[model samples]
Target: MLNRVILIGRLTRDPELRYTPTGVAVTQFTLAVDRPFTNQQNEREADFINIVTWRQLAETCANYLRKGRLTAVEGRIQVRNYENNEGRKVYVTEVVADNVRFLESANREPASGGGMREEAPQSRYGNQRSQQQDPFSDDGKPIDISDDDLPF
Candidate 1:
């Protein structure tokens, strides 16, 4: 049972942050993804998708993400239904994001005032060391490694 979805698109609008009754942070936003093929008029079309993030990730997204910023979202497709005020059953489909990445650099600011976070996200290796202190830094020089260091 595998349920996963990955999408790369520009945000249609700024993220809307909200809190639940338990005080947990939640954010919702819409992503405008361009379709691969063009329409009859040869004009490209885009699909608007709803994205939902929870917990600390939600707050992070709310603070850093802005409208028209390119982003990548990885999550599962969720479909739920509820009765509207008219008593008609309504179904909603959205992505419950587990990971959200800002594809564009913070230096590139849109017409809107808000911008992304200044600091880059750390690598999976945990703490990020300065480039000058990195032993594996690529300085256009060949790296010296012994055969013993090569697992192959």
Candidate 2:
């Protein structure tokens, strides 16, 4: 048996982070992915997918991800059932993300003195990255990356 799913899309809203009673971090968010084909009316359609992250990755995602930011999510599709307030069974299908990649950099604040990445996104492990749109430089250019910065 095999179960896997991968998607690249923009965030429909900011990820909501919370901790369990044992201090386990968790985050939930929705991703808006456009369909490859347009509708009959010639308008593109999008699918809103639910994503869930756990542990350090959850914290990283909540801290760095924001609405409208493009991202890639890799995970398994999960379906669970629960009882609602009216005593009715409700089923939810969501992606349990194991890996997430930030495809866009956050807008930098002008007050920053250096051309450093203000909002770097990391994985379960901490990683720092920066791109175009610097606040310290007048041109707002992306800072150069050293070969050492690449994780291979």
Candidate 3:
């Protein structure tokens, strides 16, 4: 069965990191995702989705994610039930995120006033990596590629 889900939204609150009895790291956060269409009142409504990440990803999320930060989550849907203290069965549905990406840079605000050139992307893994020059990013000057360059 297929159970993959991908979502892009802002965090409703700061991530909560905790450790289990086995010393495993876990983080839980909520993502506020706005529905595609507006309601009759022309107001956009948002859904708060619970997300859980484990191990290194959990720690990474806890360290980097903050409230109202835009992020992309890739994971699967998990639904589980437990008995409450009041003898009621409570069902919980959460996304067990395996991969989470920060859409914007931690140092830069999304809507800074002054117009500035866009910077290369950064990942949670490493520092600014040197991006290979894109052939299309030049001054509209085309590189001469001879027929000999084609192996076929």
Instruction: Write the number of the candidate with greater lDDT, choosing between 1 and 2.
Output: 2
Superposed Cα deviation of residue 118, candidate 3 (Å): 15
Off by over 4 Å in 3: 107-152
Clash count (model 1, backbone only): 0
Evaluate model 2: give its TM-score.
Answer: 0.74
Model 3, backbone clash pairs (residues 3+ apart or across chains), number: 0
Q: Which stretches of candidate 1 lie over 4 Å from their true place?
A: 109-119, 122-152
Give the candidate order by descending TM-score: 2, 3, 1
Against the hidden reference, what TM-scores do the models get? 0.73, 0.74, 0.74
Clashing pairs for model 2 are: none
What value does the lDDT take at residue 36 in candidate 1?
100
CA lDDT, every model vs. true structure: 0.81, 0.83, 0.82
Candidate 3 or 1, higher TM-score: 3
Cα lDDT, model 3, residue 65: 81
Cα RMSD, model 1: 7.3
Residue 87 alpha-carbon offset, candidate 1, angstroms? 0.9
Residue 147 lDDT in candidate 2:
97
Clash number for each model: 0, 0, 0
**Cα lDDT tens digits for candidate 1, 1-152:** 99999888899999999999999999999999999999999999999999999988888888778898878788999999999999999999999999786766555543333333223553112224365666667699888889999999
Off by over 4 Å in 2: 108-124, 127-152
Over 7-55, each residue of candidate 2 has an lDDT whose tens digit, in order, gives 8888999999999999999999999999999988999999999999999
Ranking by lDDT: 2, 3, 1
